[model samples]
Target: MMITEALRLQSQGSKHLHFLIDVNDEQIIYSNQSFINQFSDIKNPAALLPYIENEDLKYVMEKYLACKSGEKVEDFESRVYIDGKRHVYKIAAALLIISTGQHIVGCDAEDITDLKDYINVLNEHNKKKNSILNIVSHDLMGPIGIIQSLSGLLNDPEKKTDEQRLYQYIDLINRTSKKCIALIRNFINQEFLESSGVSVVKKKSN
Candidate 1:
């Protein structure tokens, strides 16, 4: 929007960028000071296209065209490159009409680069944590299930029929107990390894 009054200058502050385009004349009418200071090269919509990411450009243009048809676009997130650095922006566009019945599209954009970076890091951490949980649930269950099944036989007097069967069950239980202990150690060591710098070391084979 054009700075016709004193209040207009105060409205466009340094926090966000604002620009206006004349829908009737198909020209960029005005750009706020913050917009000009940051995007000095982008004077018009055509000049701004190259800086917009492919997907973001498509979405923003769709919203811009919608605004021409008297539709409002709000919280439209888009990626734009300013001096080779990518930045996320929350944009809103709306159709505006002054007393003269002149149609204009008012677009407001707020930089949200820091917020987007923080969300991406959180998503990556969630993925790694889920992978560790899967190993604990599936891999460790095998030895535990074997030990539980043999434990029942060892406890039952009727199931422990002969000397040979007794030795077999005892040996199986011993080996399963060792396997379970190793799994527990590995799980604990892995947790400490990622959080700090401590982990279990496997014995080297000759």
Candidate 2:
């Protein structure tokens, strides 16, 4: 199928599909009803040209101009807002030479806003999960190590009956228990910092 025919068919199916065709060195074409209605003050494509000074459109037009000179242009993705709602679009363009030998650029755009939003949500969820894992690991380490050390000392045959060794083991257990308490306190402080959107930083004094 011809590129123009395919573009027309797509415009008919998707109400949000917008276009701008450079015709006869003087006119621009658009298939989106919302665009036409919202920018009615521009009256025609010529007047609308000045308002479409966005970076994405500028890049697209530059590539389209290059394609007219027999250079191949690849598809690109960009975000646009129409009627206050953000839309992510993938744009593809091709150059066509008519029977009159006039070169025209045919562009097609597809909306992918929903897919981009879903991916953003997944990314946020992963970040929160990682933060929680870090907090949990830090909190659990001291207690688990103390339990391991205490169990080892209690299981030692020779040290089990020695009073001095038993007292030393008790001192170690006490120190480890204090460490576990400190870990819990640190976890609480971290939680407060996170809730307040504040980060923990080391102080450097001159």
Among all candidates shown, the one with the greatest TM-score: 1
Clashes of each: 0, 0
Compose the digit string of candidate 1's lDDT tens values, residues 66-157.
99899989998999998899999999889999889999998889998877765665565567768988987787788778878777777887
Candidate 2 structure lDDT? 0.62
Residue 101 C-alpha lDDT in model 1: 93
Task: Go through the candidates in order and give the C-alpha RMSD of each one to the true structure.
Answer: 8.0, 10.2
Tens digits of lDDT, candidate 2, 33-93: 5445445534244454343437677775666668667675656777665556666776676
Candidate 2: segments with Cα more than 4 A from true spot: 1-10, 23-26, 34-62, 71-75, 160-206
